[model samples]
Target: MNLRRRLAWLPLAAFLAGFLPATPSLAAEPGSENMLAHRAAYRLKLDSVRDNASIEQAEGIMLFEVIDACDAWASRQRFTLLVGDRDGNIVETTSDYATLEAKDGSSLRFSLTQMTGGAVTSRVAGEASVTPQGGRIRYQEPAATEDELPPGTILPMIHTIRSLAAARAGQRIFVAPLFDGTSADGAQDTTTIISGGWLAPQPNANFPLLSTLSSARMRIAFFERNTTGQGGGAATPDYEVSLRYYENGVADELKMDFGEFVVDGRLGELQTIPSPC
Candidate 1:
């Protein structure tokens, strides 16, 4: 599925964005697909706030879905958050993000729109390619411009497929430049941390498909390209997401750290869609 999505503030949508992937071709190998095509609703709330933080309270809901479109994967996510500041004033923000990705890790189309107080604040839409020699990103909205993606750039779906396959194969971590079309930056260097090893099929009684799949716990951090942190090494990540993910690509129990405050996403609902395969 993907480490995918972004909210207007997107702190919520952003977490899911990390997990969602673009569409994969029907030729995808077994055990590397999205596994479960499903719609998920996550309830979000303040997990914590730094003492000096301006955000005193936060609450929101995220609606996300992934569809098996036969030849490719299609996904849509909507995030809305009502945040209260130290002054006790409330602000509402929302973001809508969507994508259609090829199954062979060759291409992707993405769109993201953000609004605050019911007015559009920002929008970005584009198409990108993935290849061994690097690819190009052609932005079609907000402005007409093109950028070069660094060599070895992988889109979300392929990144997830490779990551999961590695984890299942006993590899602990891997770093890659990921281009999900979520930000203006052509690609962000991502470091994925896998933990708890690979799990056995514990079977979720609530979701039939989950009952047959093994799972993993992972944390992924997104770092801006060419940026350095305090010690002159890699810069601190802009955001971090931790979640439990199933082999079929279903994710639950999420933690999103947005610097100012942290939010948690609890899966309130899940329904798997039938795949054409």
Candidate 2:
């Protein structure tokens, strides 16, 4: 993946919005107000670099907000990265993304815009729907494109719910294909998750909201789902993320791995919003 594509995924914080069951019923599906409406701010710090010698210093901020929209979940996220290279010059990359996911897990719509040096450099917008046969996407920006979603495809919110349910049931590993409209490449992602079961939140944790809910530590890896076997079996992931997830769907203590380097996102502020419902 190119640097732009790798950075594009950083603005996908909405996917981690809280999705825990309100009633503590294992069979219960998330409904209105089940997902906590909140905004979280994070400090983006360089974790490490392996192949990217151009980077000397890295810093930024990420802001993510999610709201309960009755029958759908609405979200907005932005991330800005300030990079100082060996040349003693700084470059700024900013990503802004918004999304809506139907509560039924049947549909998702997204818009993404990326800016470099204060100028719009790229845009991707699309809608995806799930059908009995499979899933499909229709793009409306940056030129039109259409593609079929691989079998057993899941959208972001549903994917989180599935993960939460699995954790609640004491399942250690889960795998599923997901399409979050982050890119126009039409590559579906297959995610594998190894999870530690639920535990009480620590008082010293950065996000106070976590203290009111059950939590788990999860290591998730993403791999491209290649149906035609064209993408060699040894194909590595585009990226991977490990984080602490709360029963209410909040994720913090994030470590994002982009093959060449790693970035850490630490929660700096968190505020719960009133649910309209």
Candidate 3:
């Protein structure tokens, strides 16, 4: 993937929200106001390189925010990366991604903008709806086009809820297609591998919101639609993320695989916002 495409996903402080269900119901009820409304800062640095990817050194920061907007969840992610190629050429890439998801998980509004060398390269803005027949997206910024969402598709927060449910239910693996409108392509297939069962409360006095919640270790692989898990063995993922997911919706010790290189995103600071209900 080119830098523009990579930016669409590489550092998703997305779902910047948190959730821990009382039971393994697997249903998303955004109106419950269980999601943590907070902002998190992550320090990003190169963890490894692969395929001879050009990288003298790379560093970045990702700022993530999730707000409870009365009847919906609003999230925004700001990411900036400075990369030094083999010959000492420096390129700065940045992206702003934002979304508004309804309380019922029935609708979503999304926008993503990417820049490289201070020049705008891509912009994707759209609205989508989930229905019994499936989902459809209507793009308004880049162009006027409509796309179909595969059946059984889900939005990001619901994906988190379902994954948590499956994890709590002792299911080691879960597969689903997700549409967050981060890219022009409507939905991407995902395979979530639960590394272990629930985690006991790990004390964190500095971040009181996550102090007493259970957590799970999960690794998720994102793939191009219909390119995986059918006939041949599992195809390589376009992007992969493994993290320590807390019941309160905080993810720390993030390892993001960007095809050519991997980046680690560790939480640096956190503050919870009171619900404005």
TM-score of each: 0.86, 0.85, 0.88
Q: CA lDDT of 199 in candidate 3?
A: 75
- Estimate, for each residue in 1-277, the C-alpha lDDT of model 1 and write its tens digit: 0122334222111222443455456465345455557789999999999778888888999888877765566778888888889898888888888777776767878888878878887777888887778899999877899998877777776777767777798888868877887767678777888998898988566667677778888888877775442211156886678887777777877888777788898888998778765
TM-score of 3: 0.88
10 residues in a row with least lDDT, candidate 3: 16-25
Residue 264 lDDT in candidate 3: 83
* Candidate 1: Cα lDDT at 251: 81
Candidate No. with top lDDT: 3
Residue runs of model 1 more than 4 Å from their true location after superposition = 1-30, 203-205, 227-233
Residues 22-49 of candidate 3 have per-residue lDDT tens digits of 1222344632344578888999998988
- Point out the higher-scoring one by TM-score: 1 or 2: 1
* Deviation (Å) of 151 in candidate 2: 1.5
lDDT of 1 at 229: 24
Predictions ranked by TM-score, top down? 3, 1, 2
lDDT at residue 92 of model 1 (Cα atoms): 83
